[model samples]
Target: MADFFPEEELLAAIDLGSNSFHLAIARLDHGEVRKVASMSEKVQLAAGLDADKVLSLEAQQRGLDCLSRFVGRLGSVTPQRMRIVATNALREATNAQEFIDKAQRILPKSIEIIAGREEARLIYLGVSHTTAAGGRRLVVDIGGGSTEFIIGQDFEPLQTESLQMGCVAYTRQFFLDGQINPMSFERAKAAARKEVTAIAAIYRETGWDTVVGSSGTIKAARQLLMQQGLTDEQGHITYAALEKLREQILKWKHTDDIYFEGLKEDRKAVLPAGLAILMGLFEILGIEKMGYSDGALREGVMYDLLGRFRHEDVRDRSVQALMARYYADPRQAERVALTARTLFEQVADALKLDEEDGDLLRRAAYLHEIGLAISHGSYHRHGAYLLEHSDVPGFSKVDQLRLSFLVGLHRRKLRVETRAQVLHAGGQSLLTLCLLLRLSVLFHHSRYDQVVPTFVLSIIDEKTWQLAVDQHGAEWPMLQADLQQEIVQFANWGIELDIVQLIKAEIEA
Candidate 1:
């Protein structure tokens, strides 16, 4: 079995959803992904959240156990070839790190908690790749904890939004007693309507030609509707069919008594809330009929991983978009990026850094000046705040936080707070990248077309570095002074910087 599949050809994705955990394993077949194995378990992680937003221990255990089983099935899929993303449940959990820390012990890879909009983007990518391409399309995914709405053409998402309304969440809110009555349904539909209202005007303004739904709720709803002849053979859920489904749902006084030929036992409990949310969307967004797609978050994640492997990374495009939006100085950014890369290559091995570290450093260099768009005063702080808060499409939450830390500390004094933040972001490796970026920026302080003097940087030890310039100290007094100031800053962070200049006499001798 090991010899049958090459490691590089196998890719895996795990979606730690609010209601269920899903694992999808695919094989690269002629540039397309072919599913080899897939599994899903209803953990209902969001249902375990308390009013204060802490994930309960039992829920965490359930999630961990499910992950353990999924890991056992991930045969020969290397860590680099796999991606695991957690959606709304973990995003809102106050103690999400507590669960993540425990889950990491059972799984080989770390779990990334993606932003809501990013989640929307991935869902669109999954759907676009699997479904036929048409004009602008509206894709809706209803999960256990949140629902993502995206409008996109082809493989690119034009607009994406994720709302805090989902099957499990709404079940807890409007159907906690498991009662299936018109009053409860009305309240749930009203809540969903209100949430959809926030984005309706703009969505209507930028309309889609076809509407499609993905993930568990929509799939189960479509199946049940098709089985009952409520919809056509194509499995389209029309408003009329949805209305019929609602009437039948209200027939049962409670969720436990609800039964449908195609609906799974686990899906029955949340079906009413899911139906209410869908009906509200149909009315508010004027969606007459919607089609279901098997492709979802896990599938999207696998496609995204494939893109990275092919060097078609969406992150590079996202970074470029951010730079353009903030009116960054392209030449200056290029200068810093080039110099940072040069320094990284020289010291990467000594610092135990990898290609990922180098990539992060280069990106940080390009965006280090983004804060200048808002104000010149403490612009680094402004840039940090923006990166940390912005909905960058392809970056995970940790990726944003790490980028924020590097950009924030690129210039200013390395304060005590800086040390703590560096530790939290990436530790010694991140601090080293920050230093390289700082020097790169300092070298380009003039920001002119003239080239800076050549310099050599070497690591003396873990705590010390040596920089040798090709010209005498007197040739560039400003640069010399800047270096001295940098020495003090480096000292604050427990790093020693030694400067050396090559005089003409020494070169001649």
Candidate 2:
């Protein structure tokens, strides 16, 4: 990783979308991104998923090959600066880890598979940043495996949703084998309408001043409409225009037989399914017209990356919101968080814990006791459940899981098997964080205001840790007992936790 990434240095975001893979590289100029290069390829990852929710080997290879090409274009940008996000395709795949492991070998950065709601939030962020912002706007992004619907104002999304009806998935379901006809289109629209109907009532009640569409399907429809003179000078998609396009689509006998002036060959197969989804959305939401925005997930990710560098990280805000909502003991939470940071600083390099890992530890430390708000009995489990399930903005699903794992293990006897499952890919690094958090919690068991002890934390090796407490014996007998139990706890995870108290050392000497 580069030690210093200048403001003018390039930043990149790769969206491993279900239908297509997209890469965007840009430089931050005066807090805004100036695009240097962008690439998109039809990977159709969603089409590769089987009935068992396993991604086919062929599909994984397509995605990996596309990423290999993208990695070639990402010149000089450090992996730390690039954000790679995977969407519904990977999220639904039971064997996504196999694909992710393969992808990581080829790409410079690890792939983050975001929850659907998080995807919606990022999509809204990108659209809001690029388009004019004022009144409440509804944003819709139709991707290969899923569609996201968001309503927000001035960069904050009030209501965000991700529906399972996506273009490529629907294309396979309703328009397989290149068949194109009125009946097929109607079947596709009816299926889409059924899906949208569930959320229509709520979204309609909370409506928008302007409706905007993002990503490939919407863009293709808007461009084709403009070329056909169905849209006005502004190139907005109207219901009447969509209906005409639907008619043109039904006239075609097969996907290849369909021809529009601006339609790309890659989009032809999935266009009808996309059109069906759009028509369903328009009817259900009562949308008369919608404008298009070039900004979507990739752009949103770039802006989010820029925000992290600018110290406006949304994850921090999310943690704060979680603490407040859970009515956490702020004083105790702060004490643990501070102590956790102290311990992390001592072992960060030794354990290969980066700043990101430190952030995860601190957040997990602050939120660890949140379960007390629910019940003191197994509060850690309660806290873990809350963090794991909540729609926390800016946190990817994996991020939440890691935090949950730490909070879940903060106080109790270590469940080695469970921790291994939760932090499988992370391995020792996450286990090390969990142990550090456990120690921090044990040290602050009293939860009263007190000066943190001056302690020397030394790593004897990867599996052993030594903590030299400054205080003499009987100065903190309660903490001494807790430390003794912690040794047994650490032993459960195959790590040695040795506590060195000043009084014991003096007596031995």
Candidate 3:
């Protein structure tokens, strides 16, 4: 038999959740992934956020300290095979960059702060992969700072929504004093109900066959219920059991007094708040029972990474979806993407570009004209706004911003602020990709099926590039004029673009 599991074929994912940090390492055997190791720590990162949405230094340190230990447990998992994802806490923190910069120093991979919808999608991916399929299923994950809800079939998510209500955040909001009174619990439930109301109608309209819960909050609930003999044989939490658990919790005057068999001390503080939110969901959504899953965001990240390695990247699907949604011309997109990729190959070595960079350029090239769907006037600006703001699945916040920078500056005069933004996002490498994309778009300005003249692009130095075109071609004059204009644009961006005729010997060779 062919070797299904190669030596050291391991993948890792780190989930920097608002309340805890999780590290999961898995090995790919055959077509399935089996967990090799896992670890989690309740850092309560969201609990550190002040009223101003600023993450406190103490919380930042707590997160960093946890990551420092996680890094030690990484073992043989290389940086390229690992992904770090941050959820609601980092997304809401005003000074998140300050925390991320410090965390990056401890871990080799940079942290990706995913949008809420994207987080929901990943959560569903993890659940669907781990659990047995049953028509359509509703997956809910109550985290530290946010709760993600997803309805999916098998491995595909149908509807996804994220609410900015979580155990840690709600604890701060309604249970800071540890009081478990009916009024306080009702208040918490009312607040949760209000948040759920926004998407309740649509979710109920598109109902599910089974209800599954993931993440630490729900997992803790199931474990505690099982310990108390409140769960069914299948380990599902029923509405009756949930109510009974609530009654039990309300008997305690404070969080410290709340006690249950098999309940970890660390989970005590957030248990009441988590129960309130879950109960609120059950009442509002009319859910009868919920089955728990060990899978969650970190597992989803590993599965996503595996897809990338297996040539089934979801980001490509997301890009195609965006293009189709914006009514982009596939032919034009193909033309520009092909040309951009060709240019990328020529200077990739000098620019230190890799397959990932090439992928970004290709996607950006295909989407450069998405803004034309809105209006031709400053459509680049419009397109940039759409890309940055759109809840695109399988893309991180930084990925969207970098893509926006390329599309926004593809045709217009490059602004200093735009350049600064691009530099801050991906630095010189991204700028080079932008330059290549611009040249490709310029070459196909006529939007015709006619072939573009052969051109050889070479790097002269860090800030200089030389492009030798076939001067004898029929479209030479028009192309030359376009190049001259592009030269001025490149100069504005502090890059020199030198154009010359293609040498006969070089062309023939």
Winning candidate number (lDDT): 3
What is candidate 2's local distance difference test score?
A: 0.88
Model 3 CA deviation exceeding 4 Å by range: 1-8
Question: Which ranges of candidate 1 are over 4 A from the true structure?
Answer: 1-8, 473-475, 502-509
Q: Please report, in order, the local distance difference test score of every candidate based on alpha carbons.
A: 0.90, 0.88, 0.91
lDDT tens per residue, model 2, 260-347: 8767898999999999999998988899889999999999999888788777889989988998998998899999999999999988
The candidate that achieves the highest TM-score relative to the unseen native structure: 3
TM-score of every prediction relative to native: 0.96, 0.96, 0.98
Model 1 C-alpha lDDT versus the unseen true structure: 0.90
Encode model 3's per-residue lDDT on 304-358: one tens digit a residue: 8888877788998999999999999999999999999889999999989988899
Per-residue lDDT for 199-247 in model 1, tens only?
Answer: 9999999999999999888898888888888887777899998889899
- C-alpha lDDT (0 to 100) for residue 368 of candidate 3: 95
By lDDT rank, best first, the candidates go 3, 1, 2
Clashes of each: 0, 0, 0
Error of 1 at 277 (Å): 0.2
Candidate 1 pairs with clashing backbones: none
* Poorest 10 consecutive residues by lDDT, candidate 2: 500-509
